[model samples]
Target: MSILVRGMHGLGDNLHQRAVIRQLMARDEVFLESSWVAPYHDLVAAGLKILRKATPLRTQSKNADREASLFHRGPLPPRAQEVRITYTPDLVRARGSVLAAMCWATATDYAAADFRMAVPAEWLQQAKLLFNAWQPRKPVLVYRPLVDRTEWGGCRNRNPDHGAYAALFDAIRDDFFVVSIADLVPGQEWIVSRQIRADVELHKGELDFETLAGLFKLSAGVFASPGFAVILAQAVGTPVACVFGGYENSSSFAGGARFSPTLGIDPINPCQCFSHSHACQKSIDIPAASARLRAFFAEAARHWPGCA
Candidate 1:
């Protein structure tokens, strides 16, 4: 019997869910049915077929029953089984294993293996062309600056201040070609560095998932806020240095400890207003964070001979 997996909402959530789906694919014929298919088309091309004929559903609904019903929509072929899996901070904390929690929810057996993401060969070629066009002189470090708005699940408070990001960019530009991958909103351009430097480049426009995966694969390391990019970098075997405001615990996420050696701020005493509002009173030591990040890169450089 073939299995159908319900999709999660955000890019990061969907990426994390792949750990479970990959295992299911190993045991049974599996297909993903979700409205969020565009971000993961690279996987589809790599052999994970998606149910495109299924009716698209909104990410959330007012009625809880309706929300669950979306997964049941569209016709399934004979002998197709549906599986539902949910990953949350509570589940991660309780299970002490992100992969296990994802597998437990879907009733799949977990295997100890590295998380895998498919970067299409074409996309890798495109990334090579793009990087060559930029003519970077030093090792490139990719980054994503958090937007100032609070649209995606009250995450605005987790975004570092523009000044703090500016300090970080300034600190690292001498040794690494720093690139910001965030698609900034109009009038919100100041969230990243404005200084004219040869080593700094702001990637304008929206980049598709394949291109992003390719970029991550080519980078020396990634420095990003808590978001999809961090997970993407990890999936491509690139080390990450995460910058957080005060909301998330560093250990709560799957790759936070394994891939990220340094965090921008301490998560031990999180601000009371975390994950709810943007009025955070916690202070981030930008200079110290920058030094730690440099140290991380130095360690990574030893393994990546070209980066040295």
Candidate 2:
């Protein structure tokens, strides 16, 4: 029997899933499936031997420890040993206990896959579609707007602040649209209201990886976050002016970005990100970030020979 491991959560979780699958597949024929996992359904579809657990009539199940097993009753392409591992300590050695062994077994260990770095082929295709659908004459501007849980001193979250980096587009609003992936509330949509000068796209569920890739292909430059999208954008062959959020994960994640004022890198007074309350999100200085971003764009234009 082949194995089907679940728990494909956010970028980090997906990495765990992939890592575990890689380990299992090395020994026996294992199939990695993540349909029961939200946000990663498309990814699972793009891969082979992955059966969806969504359609009850479409899945296939066998008599196994029902509690320990997670099976798809759908069209079973070819059955593999099935198991489920979450983003729990038991799976990844969270506590540094002999735990990783106690839980997964110490006999022969399989290193987990680094999900953030693993871009599914489907997402690349999605990016291609986005570029093709939105045909623009002017160079594109791709951005990742910061979303904070709360506001604090100099921690502006509105359009004026977020668009501080807008100077990169050469004042061509029709040519560029910034992308925001932060889950925005109806009331919070206006945070980036000022980007009206430039076409700004807030990518909720509507825009997938293909759309993002398309945008990257069409862009003159990117204003990236310290997040997953930024990593993807850079990898898609786009010149990016990125800014880190608050920690080492901020810099190391997207191949490194200029740290934001909210990250103690800003020259502004009292450095909002330096506060003890973890106000970095709120303290990100829009103007400071924007200035650096604009410079990066200009440099890209001057040097990014094929990218323009």
Candidate 3:
């Protein structure tokens, strides 16, 4: 049997779907989008087939049935099926993590879904080269200044106050070498300008996925809105100080789709505000957020001893 699993939407969405995709690959021949293959280097090396020129799908805030139908050129072959992780309002209401939702959608064991990936040695070598060139005395903390915005998708409501982020970075600058990174490519004007203050601006959008993953492994932590950076940091075993806001709850992205009382650095939605607009993001308390970040890094230092 063969299954063509559509990993549509952003890098983050595809990443969340990786574990489920891995399960499917074990049971049947699996096909995935070509563009999405970069983050799946291990899976590709393990033999996941690539499908080129396929229409990528986004199920969030859209009709799932219609979106799933887009994957079909004709009727699927006998004993085969197409799969996509669909977002429902109820999923948010129930506070389900994307990984669990994907598992349910695919009939895969939720307990088996792991977000971690194997970083290639070459990628780490490149990151080491960049790190040595910087010559920083302090530990590295990568900052993601922008939430992803592509020609077809984005969510401004998730963006926290930039000024607050700047203040927080300044507060911690003495102890950490803050390096801000952005995904801005040749023509992504919709992503807006990178505006965060940091010791170095690696925001030229030069870092590729593998290199970025490797960098995350080398860094002390990541500071960003709840997005791919948070996921990647977790995958690489690096701590993250997530500046969460907007309509979503912190649990939607954190430990097992719920707040982990044990994890000190859960996403900080200080204001506890929720709305469809950017006002919720704007409501975050800068001082509280900064305090949380500082505490989080202090805890990270205890774990790494030499890094944070």
User: Model 2: how far is 190 from its true place, Å?
Assistant: 7.9
Q: CA lDDT of 77 in candidate 2? A: 39
| Per-prediction TM-score to the true structure, in the order listed | 0.76, 0.50, 0.79
**Rank order by TM-score, top first?**
3, 1, 2
- lDDT (Cα, tens digit) per residue for candidate 2, span 1-308: 55555533233333334435545555664455543332333344544244433322111111112211333445543755556664232333332312132225323342332222234466546665555565544455665555432322222321122433344233323334444444444543224423434354664435533445555554566654434454444444556554443322232332112211112122232221323345444244665555555555656555433322
* Residue range 1-308, candidate 1, lDDT tens digits: 68877766556767777767777777777778554554455555555656533332222221123224323344556868888777665666666545556766777665553355667788888778778877777778886755554345544566655566557656665777777775545543324334435454555545655677787777787877767777777676777776666555444355434543444444335443335554664456766777877778877655553421
Best by TM-score: 3
Quote the RMSD, in angstroms, for model 2.
9.6
On lDDT, the stronger of 1 and 3 is 3
Report the Cα lDDT for candidate 3.
0.63
Residues 210-282 of candidate 3 have per-residue lDDT tens digits of 6788888888777777677777776767877765545465555653322111122223443333344435525
Worst 10 residues of 1 by lDDT: 56-65
Instruction: Point out where model 2 deviates above 4 Å.
Output: 1-3, 11-27, 33-135, 148-196, 200-204, 217-220, 234-237, 247-249, 252-295, 302-308
Ranking by lDDT: 3, 1, 2
| Candidate 3 to truth, TM | 0.79
lDDT of each: 0.61, 0.41, 0.63
What residue pairs clash in candidate 3, if any at all?
Answer: none
